[model samples]
Target: MSCVKLLNDFPFTFSREATYQVCEKVETRCSFLDKLGIHLAGIWICECSCGSSDLPLDHLRSDKGWSLPNRLCPCRGPLSILKKQLCSWSEYYEWRGISLDSPVALLLHWPLTMYQAIQLAFGKQLTNETTDELCIHYLGPERELYQTAVFGELHALLPGVRVHIDFVGPEVPHDRDGETISLSSYAHCMEANCSCKTPISTDDSSKITLRFHSGYYHDCYEELTKEFLPDLIIAPNAGIAAYKSWLPTIELIREIEVPTIFSDYCEEACHLAANCITSVTGTPLAIPVQLNPFRHPLAVEDSALLLPCYSNCFLFGI
Candidate 1:
């Protein structure tokens, strides 16, 4: 389907026809991977009072209750019936023989109020601590729907890449039991195995190091640049702002020369507002005009502005 037609027919809310169409497009895309002998795995996402949580939607229903509103989330927030909207693709893919797995990443393309977006973009310029609070707020309960939608589309486009979601906090241990630990411990806490050593597969025979870094640390950006050295960085814009001050993460990113994509769901006004950030920080900005056919209805196609360090790198919204 043409991206224009898909965008026109995009479903903002749940409906049988819309859900089926979206899932059908996903299945068609999965066929591409099948032709390459790549196994398809799906990630199902849903949110509850506990925060953004993931489990197979089918598993949730079978174990908890078929009726969603009555189901009790582990955090004790009654699961909303709307949570089911995020699962249509998973069900459709599984019916078509795709292997469904626990979500590898937590999507963060949450809709932002004009007031909130302005505060976030400008707030970090004023104070560092407020940026951290804003980052946490951006990831709060309200973000579930948009995050789920964009993530679903991203899964459809690159079904072969294994994605994992994690959260990092500010507290740095001077030493582990008084001895310093390597920075990889900060990026991935588990010592036995680390996904950082692995590379995300690309269809073109290129490998990209994708890292989702979230936290309110004074030196997190410096540590990540030194240790992670990711090819691409996908971070919540608000989180970036929160960690931006004192050390100026944006400047650090520019110095390290990695392509970064910031996600915030607002209309044209938001794009203009984000441009203000790019202008002040000296980051080159590009706005994607065409929606990727696989993008979700809630995916802000024209609104997401990409900030890159150089001309060779362009934001490929996934």
Candidate 2:
């Protein structure tokens, strides 16, 4: 059975078509170990509310990601029925046989969410062009630094286009500051026969390159812009109303007049951000707050509200 048909056996909040589209980009097994300078064994540890279990790498298959397993997790909370039907980052990646040493859904979320935001702001026709280059300034990155290699999926999603991302945030580690990394090939799966298992030929010039800037955007804005100007700016899980630190950044963004997009965990957060953006920029949002189709599939634990909350659940542009 097809992955989409199998996925429909369970009750998921997201559309099957959307999930299938995202899985295509995220299903690869490439660890980018050469890029991150890390080594690993054949066992991947699975963690959840139930606990951790060691899973052998060889046992994982592409079919496991879409179909709900007999036992999702050991947790038996009130919401376990729906939760058990949901899969983790590890399971989702299994569709394409991706088995990174420590895979997190956010690893896929960052790139996919950004891709969707770009489509929302600029339309899909622009990304489909083979000759056009897309430059993005990503703000407030925290845990994503550990798995930058996973972002190589962009090349597949935006085929033949070069994507340049400048990640600016205070959470950037001191040691990696001002570092630049380029991914010239698709993140390959471990399977020996996988189509993308080999390095991309040099003839394919498209690539995804990332740069790290260690500081608040307001402080680094003037300096960063000196080198590369971006076509778009993305801020994921931006708590605009909750933080005063965003004030200067918002001011600067308004002045630059760049097409900026932001995602938050909930509608209320996006609504508040919209108000904040208008307050700072003196204009309404270009893209009103709406649900992001590329949101993380699993429910977030210990959420403040009773409503379902996932990473980058809502998005808006200014």
Residue range 111-229, candidate 1, lDDT tens digits: 11212222223432222222211111111122332122222222222223322222233321122111211111011111234332232233421111222334442345554445433
**lDDT to native, each model:** 0.28, 0.60
In angstroms, the error of model 2 at 252 is: 0.5
Best by lDDT: 2
For model 1 the TM-score comes to: 0.36
> For residues 1-318, could you state the per-residue lDDT of candidate 2 as single tens digits?
222243222223233322342344332122222122222322111212221233332222111121111122111111111212112344334333433332334345767787678777775434433346778999998645544655765665565677888999987766678888776554433444544444555433466778988999999988888878888999999999999999999999988889999999877788888888899888899998877665765444455764555678888998
What is the TM-score (0 to 1) of candidate 2? 0.68
Candidate 2 ranges with C-alpha deviation above 4 Å: 1-106, 128-131, 192-197, 202-204
